[model samples]
Target chain A: MLKKYGIRKGFIAALFLNNSIDFISIFFALIEIGATPIPVNMAFRAIELDEIFSNADPHAVITEKDHLKVIMKYLSGRIVVERNGGNFLMRDSGAGGFGRGPAEVDHSIATINYTYRGYGYPLGAMVPHIQYLFGSELLQEAVRLDAGERLLVVLPMPHIFTLIGCIFLPLIYGITPVISRSRNPLRLFETVHAYQIQNILAVPELYELLYKFRDSAGDCTPLNAFLSGGSVMPDEMYGRLVDEFDVDLIHGYGLTEFTPVSRNIRGDIRPGTIGMVCDGLEYKIDPCDEFGFGEILIRTENMTKAYYRRSAESRDVFQNGWFRTGDIGRVEDGHLIFKREKKKTRKVKGNMVDLLEVQRILMEYPKMRNAIIECNDSILSAAVEIDSARNFDSEVLSIKKFLEDRIAGYKIPKIFSRI
Target chain B: MKDNKITTVDADNLRESIIKTLAVIARINEKEINDSILIKDELGIDSIMSLEIIANIEKRYNIQINEEDTMNITTVGEFIDYVIHIINKK
Candidate 1:
């Protein structure tokens, strides 16, 4: 079918798919065929979709039946392939042929993964196939997972952590990767017991859910370890998981540009640090302050070289063959101790929400004089300096309505206050 | 003697009230909401907002909602039915 549709080498396809077997198969198949698969977040609304589609410039869009209508709005004569169960339905809108991508991107790139680091907009990280192997190799050594063990996966499929840690790592190491369709803690517990799953790689949010539903989580004894990333884990939550559940709650720090940069070793775990830097990467803290903390710089052969179509950001991030990870941290006794993030972003529900971007979107409303967005313990609130004459209540509602379509649901502030 | 169970009219009122509450929380019009629309997916409601909705329903009805009952709920209709069931049980 790919050959029939002229999906040859260098073909870029946008994947608007759910977390299902089809997503995994299609992803690997695209890579196998030498095509670049852009895994788009399912939570994205049409507005976000439009921006990504415009930037990605995909030749074809592969989506399931549920997302076909939403994807069709931005198809613009590109090829559309709807996967229903085991069958494939391919059609061409014929408005035009395959859309041209930016000529600057390397044609041999493995995948284009979209990421946002408080950049107001997302940039596609052009990850090579070698990074997957390198990242998985590092994780395998750090976690010490045997080939026969089962690894539970419940995170969003489009996320880079899921792609490398959950999907590729398991495949490469011969471990059975159990994919959970829902984040419902009860259902996940059942999956763990059913598969006798040993380890899990999830964000802190999932671990929180497990803790919340611990009383109901029937027999999670088979679980050996819980690897956390994507966001910082609260020290209290980490303590509870370790003390209550008796699981190795390993915390790692990495970005979409490069993954498994540093991780806590399985047996020799540290409570308040991101553990030692992974092998094959050279890292340093630039211009340490009084506390011996600075912006972390990593030089790795397996890191992303460019953000697709974003030349200015690409140049800004990659300096002198070292990728400036916008994370503030210090090394104490060979462990990478995280201090704070240098970027203007907050992790809401384990997803990065750029505060400046939210403020910018809030300022788009005509009535607002200024907007200040803040996060306290992962709860986002927006205080707007609106015209005093306008009804405060109605304007608050209007701001909520304005933000609903512009950004993701999680990015929308929970509380609105007058500044 | 009086019946403890909520009548059909009472259920209708409760349903309407819940839908309106969800609409207000999701920042959408009541007319935009349908029984079949997904609470999280279509309405752009996240887990935090869902908790708010659950809290509102719990306070209004004077009942406690368990995590398991709300966790597997996919659609708005399911949520409405579950709440109505809880109210009836009360």
Candidate 2:
């Protein structure tokens, strides 16, 4: 079906789990035949969907029957894979068949992921061919994944980081990946126990839930390692996991732009550091004097070619052959330690304050379990969740008093809420 | 008696009903429960537990409690009264 539509050239494919497993199967089969697959996130709303499709301009879009009306309105000259029945149509394109052998082409742009909330950049990031190859190779070398390893992937497939690290990397090494459609905590644990999953790749939020389940279960089954990304892993939670489960918690730093950059390979892992850069990737810190933290610039063979259609916007960040990650980090003794990004910083009384620092400080209080520091241009506010049945007001007041002495009065949070 | 008046059920009866309802819903031990117990605090019942309790109580008693009635229930006594009021209605 793919070859008949001249989709032999690398193309983007849209897949929603409900109606498009057949399309996905065929898409993976195409990948085996050297056709690049662009997997779109099903979570995208109409406005966000239009922006991505307009920018990417994929050669073909494979969608389910339910999403056909909305997708067909925006896309033209494409192939539609219907999921309701076993009917496939190559719309506006001719010539179809399979197996023409692998085409030797430069792995320029393999896939494009759209960012959430349209915050950082319009098109999230592009994964080039070389980067995927190098990243998969680097992860394979670092993790020592065997063909018999059972990997539990808890994150959504559309997320670029999970796509490469958990899904593609495992496929590359011939490891079996157990993909669960449900995120229900009990069901997730059932899947783990049922499959005897040894390796897990998940976000910090899912890790927290799993930790609670493990505590309740009493008897602990050792997982090889828990790989976390997508958000900052709280230090206290990291410590608890190590103490209780005796499992090494590995952290990787990557975004939609650079799929998988750095990973804590050996179990001798640092809690807060993102570890060394992946092989075949070059990184440097942008100049900053205050905290020795700067924008992380990465130059790699796998860096995205360009923003699909936003040439002018792409040029702003992609300068002099290096892609500006907008993430702030400090290189400590050769390892890249990621701090909060500059955009997350706030200015008070002409003094700059890092929100992550405030969060870390609040997390130190015994009563507080989780904290998020949110700041607008003028005022900074904090939301904290405490252990069940604990009074958070006293803790919040104490934190405020402590900050008053250490930081400027203006830097202290103006409002605090128990969430 | 008024149509919506809850019958003055004794503590033993309330305790038996509550325990049976909770056990049926969550497969938890009902014998350990008491009238003075806080459903969440004493039982280590989280929000999911509360949701299951609400569903089971409605099905067993053939009664429906509004969101407002459930929100006001902080203690097991109040939860009993809330369920009785809904059951008495029908």
Candidate 3:
């Protein structure tokens, strides 16, 4: 079955897939045969996908029957979509010679997952096998997986955190991480009850939604704890999960480059802090302010050195083998308390909104002259400037409507200003 | 195009504007804000988003939306009706 498709030692395969068993199987198969699997986010629209397609030029793309058209529209390479049957997909891709014969592990690129750039282009962080070893070991111990662990997954497959926390770690730990396609809380509730899911991996945005649907799912579900990262979990939402459901809400912190740098340990929860640093990772606070708040710098064996094809940007962040996390935090009593971001980025409803990115996009609007975006109290505010002859006040709604077609909803600035 | 005088907002305009504001604030499509759809469940509008909608409503119409008016809004139609009523009084 693995006899085809010219799979070289460092073959970069872009996987445009949904959260299904097939997605997992293909990812493992790609790795088993010495091919680097790049997980492409399924939520991307044509414009965003165009940007990514240009950035990560892959050898091949493996998607599902539903997403074949979208993938084909952008990519001009060997494309494979899994049919309903298992053996069929294998025969199809293999007969096409997608696999580069016997798999051998050596010095080759492992995987490339993109990091969101608010102001700049998306960075494809290249991870090596050694980094994967450290990441897998760190996550397995941090998540506290048990032999009887049945994990529920709601996040996308392509994300670095999801790749480790949901996919790889479960495989290594000998557990099937139950993946759900729907983001609706009711569907998640059904999956949790049906599978008796004891561990769940999600982002803060979904956690907030689950908190809203707590009443309907409170008694029926069997979730022991939920491991969440990606955004700062609001203190109120955190307290509600703990107090209302008696659930262990673990807030782990790390970027797409590497994660589990720190996570709130079970039973020793801090509502606003990104828990104690994960074992095997060393963190240093480059003091930047008088209040002991500074840029969080981490040097871990598992960290990726440079962004794929982004040498300059990679050099900017990864200096002296320490990744400058652009986040401002203070260590208090063993917990890393995040103050604010040093970079012009903020979390709005759990999505990282880059102010510079927003401004750059804003400038593209026909009437837009210049703009400044700020995140105040988690509410995005944009001060837009236009040609003096045009009324900025009247263009506010139109500017926002224009943004709707371009950026995500959470990235939309709430307060519109004219300067 | 700019004016200091407050333009009279009719019921239809008020209703449309409020729904549009909710859609923008909640990050949902304007069509999703159908009259009877539960704002929280269907549109993913939480308490924070509702507050954002209220603030936007206030700012857009240049009127102070009292807490009682905001508390009464459940569905999109109800919210539009509430905003219209408040604007009429103002």
lDDT of 3 at A359: 81
Judged by lDDT, which candidate is best?
Answer: 1
Q: What tens-digit string does per-residue lDDT give for candidate 3 at A389-412?
A: 656544765676576546555666
- For model 1, how does the per-residue alpha-carbon lDDT over A17-52 read when each residue is reduced to its tens digit? 877778889898888887889999876765567668
TM-score of chain B of each: 0.91, 0.69, 0.77
Q: Against the true structure, what is model 2's DockQ?
A: 0.06
Worst 10 residues of 1 chain A by lDDT: A96-105
Q: Which should have the higher TM-score, number 1 or number 2?
A: 1
Instruction: Return the TM-score for candidate 1, rounded to 2 decimals.
Output: 0.85
lDDT (C-alpha, whole model) for all candidates: 0.81, 0.63, 0.71
Comparison by lDDT, 1 against 3, better one:
1
Candidate whose TM-score is highest: 1
**TM-score on B-chain, cand. 1:** 0.91
Candidate closest to the true structure, highest DockQ: 1
CA RMSD of each candidate after superposition = 5.7, 13.1, 10.1
Ranking by DockQ: 1, 2, 3
- Ranked by DockQ, the better of candidates 2 and 3 is 2
| Ten contiguous residues with the weakest lDDT in model 2 chain B | B40-49
Better of 1 and 3 by TM-score: 1
Per-model DockQ: 0.12, 0.06, 0.04
